[model samples]
Target: MGQGPSVIDQATFKEMGLLSWAIIDLAINWGGWAVSAALQTDKFYDMLGTGSFLTLALGSMAAAKVSHARKYLVSAMVALWAVRLGAFLVARVWKVGHDSRFDEAKKQPFKFWIFWTMQAAWVFITLSPLLLLNTASAGGPARIVWSDGVGVALYAIGLIIEATADAQKFAFKMDPANKGRFIDTGLWSYSRFPNYFGEMTLWWGIFITCTSGLSGAQFVSVASPLFVMALLFFVSGIPLQDAQAKRRWGDIPEYQEYRKRTNLLVPVPKSLFCGASCGPKSQ
Candidate 1:
């Protein structure tokens, strides 16, 4: 019988694959960074993130000759998410004229560079599952499994939650009566940061989808969801938004009351989780 492939060969392939992907991340993010920093503008910063996701997903599929239905499934989910979120951000930024998040950061060289690099890291880590899936040695098409169905269902639920919340918020903002008011109705009533929750949920769905094709070390791609959770909970997403919310609505009694009652991430009703506090205030 012929000898099995050496451990050295496998390790080499893995390192090379990761290096290639890193190169792609840098090319997209840093390249965009150079332009944005030079122009002193952030109009396209969010687009860069989405563009990186789409570029790498499709490009990796092409590069690897990925014909497996499982791989295509992963790529398609990524494409759908990247496009939807990207379009929303682009439109919102255009309407608002500028992103408050980048106001000072874009002016400082180190801060701006960190923004791009961190974004690259975010893209690489978030796309790890799909990247690993597509780059793996293909064994032809795969049959749809229970896991795939579950993944698709979770993805659908998350996407709907995120899209609906965004649309609802947009409508509320458009109403002249809501000029200075915070959104506390619809999905916002369920969770203070339902969009973030939805974002995390959808990524977990992608991770689960990739599991059908992942094994051994490849399973480390679970970092996709974990990194997102950490970013939102600890690092960037929730913390920044929460701070901004506090600055804007902290002094309002209604906002403070809502904050005290609302779940921070999950959409569970306060009444379900709280006993007496969730009850209506006494007159």
Candidate 2:
């Protein structure tokens, strides 16, 4: 906004262009992983994963010749979400000393490197929409479309839901009385994985915001949200958590009952009034 040639208009991007930009982005992502892998600590993965996306989005905008309000707004949203998520996860790992998910992976170099590569992929794929929007030449000055308003609203709701769910779960875990018990209160009461739901929703909202500006091959960026949903639903998020819960409480009648009534990712209205039936069944 202040001065200098826009990143998109710069001679380097003009000559080498998006392909070069993409290679640089890949380097940043892999570089972070390389550092983390050398240090042998997964602590930075969460922070770096989110931070890289923010960097890519903002960096692309900074390179562009034209400054668009929509681009700026999307950048701000990404920054806010990434910061909050990174800080939250970092604090969590700090408290726990280490993430057990890396236990076996870290012990094996090849597997661990694969994990880092996957993180890089996750960053690149999930952020495709914003990255494409920031670099695309189709749109002018970023007008406020109906999709933008709706997308922003969705993002806000998802952020609140995710934050609330995490806070509630954290609080529950802190209490001695709730020891060994799974969280079925607050947002968790409605969905087995409310946090994942919020995450998916927010990404979907982000994708929607980029829709109006997208044209031609740019539409392929819609894979951003779809990839997120798949990752959560089948790959990493839900399956892991669900298995953990099963190991911990599967034999208990209450947990089985809770699993039966509660939706997997979407919150159900019946969750509010279903009470005992919807809640954990008694031991």
Assess the local accuracy of residue 269 in candidate 1 as a C-alpha lDDT between 0 and 100: 88
Per-residue C-alpha lDDT of model 1 across residues 1-283, encoded as one tens digit per residue: 2435666555554444766987988899999899999988999799999999998887676656446888877898999999999999899989889998899988987799899999999999999988888888872338888888888888888888888888889889879999989999999998999998899899989888888888889888998999999999999889998998999999999999999889987777877888788888899
Instruction: Indicate the TM-score of model 1.
Output: 0.90
Alpha carbon lDDT of each predicted model: 0.86, 0.79
Residues 1-283 of candidate 2: C-alpha lDDT, one tens digit per residue: 6545675456665343456556766777678667777778878778777777777777877765555777777878888888888888888888878888997776666788788778878887887877777776644335588999899989998888888888888889779999999999888887898898889889888888878877888888888889999998899898898899899999999998787877787655555666657665689
Displacement of residue 72 (Cα, Å) in model 1 is: 0.7
Query: Model 1, poorest ten-residue lDDT window?
Result: 7-16
* Model 2 ranges off by over 4 Å: 1-10, 13-17, 138-142, 271-283
TM-score of each: 0.90, 0.87
